[model samples]
Target: MIDALYVAETGLQAGQKHIDTISNNMANLNTTAYKKGRIEFRDLVVGREVTSLDETGKRDLVSIGNGTQISRVWKEFQSGDLKATENPLDLAIRGGGFFEVLLENGEVAYTRNGAMKVDEDGYLGTLTGYRFSDMIQIPPDAKELEISQDGTVTAYFDNDSLEIGQIQLAGFMNAQGLDSIGQGIYVANDESGNAIYSDAGENGIGILQQGYLESSNVDLVKELVELVTAQRGYQACSHVIRAADEIMQITNDLRG
Candidate 1:
């Protein structure tokens, strides 16, 4: 009966976690460079003893019972598709790489968002006006803008003046080690290792597409399927707990 109660509790908790992930993905369906998350469950029914004593003096061996635990939430790094919107400032990656942007705090951060806009200072930046690491300044009289697959930024001015800039993309050894800073920005950590330099469209890094934006990688159909499975698992666990309770009640009535 006790085991049944613990199982039911863990199952309900896991179901709640799944719901949280689903809601988060749905909320970010329209967010650029958004990655979906998945829940992992680990069965930890045994616990090891932390302390040891003299074998003859005392028995320190202990195995405390534990139930299901949320192992970890994993993020999918699959690249999102690029959709052209005719916006010259828009950028998208065709592979697995991130754009380096300068946050308001003057720190260099990474992002996958390509729906960028220039600020009043003529600085090419995100919609939030945060500057990009490699500023691709457009001439005041520029009329045409183009970005090559190799991260080359070209601007054609009215007077035949052209300016070119190259934006470098960065990747990490362990992408999961990067911490999300909201708005699709990420800060690298020890687990993430250092950013590996790579030319766009070369190697495994993704190519850059000008006038395009990357959509969120979340798949609604996949999330729905997981939601249903979680719900059913919760129901099954509840049934087990209910049956155990019924048996316990009958035993008690017979004893009375």
Candidate 2:
């Protein structure tokens, strides 16, 4: 009976964690370039015993399972839908890649959010003011700007056009291993490997789409279904705990 209580407790914890993950995913449904999170669980075994010997002298074993535990939580890196915008600075990736931005602390962070803006100094950066790693600057007198699918940046002044710079993309071996720092930004770690920098559309990198932004990859219907399942699981665990308590109470009454 005590073991039943411990097992149900583990189940309750697992269900709560699952619900939390679903909630987070739903909350970021409208965030730009947001990736949904996934949770994994593993079964816990408390004990193992040899029950009997078979005809071939092999021992028959019985394993006692404790409960389930959270194994890992990872981000799904699948591409989100691209949304068209009138702003030329807005960009979207058609495949696998991430935009590199220099943070305030001088550390380079990777993101899929491509809603960019020009600063007062004519320097192009993200909407959050994180400058591009390469620091592409536009001339003050530039009348128009254009970005090609291959990430070539050009500025038009009257009838003449000048190539200013090129936008580069960074990729990782295991993007799911990247650590998210909120606001659609991620940082690379040992598990994610190093960032592989390259031109857009080159070396398996994704092509750039000017005037478009990537929408959040969260599926509302899926999250709602998961929420329902997690709630039911939590309720089932609660019932198990209550039953265990009642069994203990009955045993005490009999003894009395």
**Top-scoring candidate (TM-score):** 2
Let me know the TM-score candidate 2 reaches against the reference structure. Answer: 0.92
Looking at model 2, which ten-residue stretch has the lowest summed lDDT? 45-54
lDDT tens per residue, model 2, 59-94: 866778999999999999999999999799899999
Residue lDDT tens for model 1, 1-256: 8777887788778778877887899788888889988778887576565566665766465665555768888678888777879888899999898888897789888888887887787778888777878887767777888888998877877667464688889988999778887878888878788888788977688899888899999888887887788778878877878998999999999999
| lDDT of model number 1 | 0.82
Q: Report the C-alpha displacement of residue 206, candidate 1, in angstroms.
A: 1.4
Question: Which portions of model 2 show Cα errors greater than 4 Å?
Answer: 48-62
Clashes of each: 1, 0
